[model samples]
Target: DVKVTQSSRYLVKRTGEKVFLECVQDMDHENMFWYRQDPGLGLRLIYFSYDVKMKEKGDIPEGYSVSREKKERFSLILESASTNQTSMYLCASSFGGRPGYTFGSGTRLTVV
Candidate 1:
């Protein structure tokens, strides 16, 4: 079975502190993505990497960035965590051009 793992299940951050959320997948999938899920807002992509050392900004990449140095790991970094950044962050992985995506449980981040 494919599994995506997030570093945190819950997080609380100060208004302007930097934050990092890590995700690792054991499936050796070629595509890894980061998304933020919010109530009524649906899932919005933050970043995605299709290959090692390559990254692309997703729909909502303003305050966040991602790293993918290896095929099995992806990291999401918040330049400066803010109240507006508080949301459930999810990591997902999929095989090349596959229709369905498998997601991690999610990290509920609260920036106060």
Candidate 2:
């Protein structure tokens, strides 16, 4: 089975601090995505990378960025974490957009 792993299951950060969330997929999928899910908001894409060193901004990319230096690995960076950024961050991957999307367990972040 394909599996996506996130670095943290829960995180607490203060406002104005940089945050890093790591993700790795064992399937070596070509597409990796970062999304933040909130109550009543569903899943909103933050960024996605189709290949190494290439990325595309998704629906909500402000204050967030991503890196894909190697296959099977992707990272999300919050330049300056904020209270509004406190949400459940999810990492997902797909094999050439087939088989739909496989998501990580998610990182529940709280900013105070």
lDDT of 2 by residue, 1-112 (tens): 7699999999999999999999999987999999999999999999998899999999999999888989999999999999999999999999885868999999999989
Best by lDDT: 2
lDDT of each: 0.93, 0.94
lDDT string, candidate 1, 1-112, tens digits:
7689998899999988989999999998999999999999999999999999999999989999888888999999999998999999999999998968989999999999
Q: Any idea what lDDT model 1 has? A: 0.93
lDDT of 1 at 59: 96
Model 1 spans > 4 angstroms off: none
| lDDT accuracy of residue 99 in candidate 1 | 65
Deviation (Å) of 108 in candidate 2: 0.4
Collision pairs in model 2: none
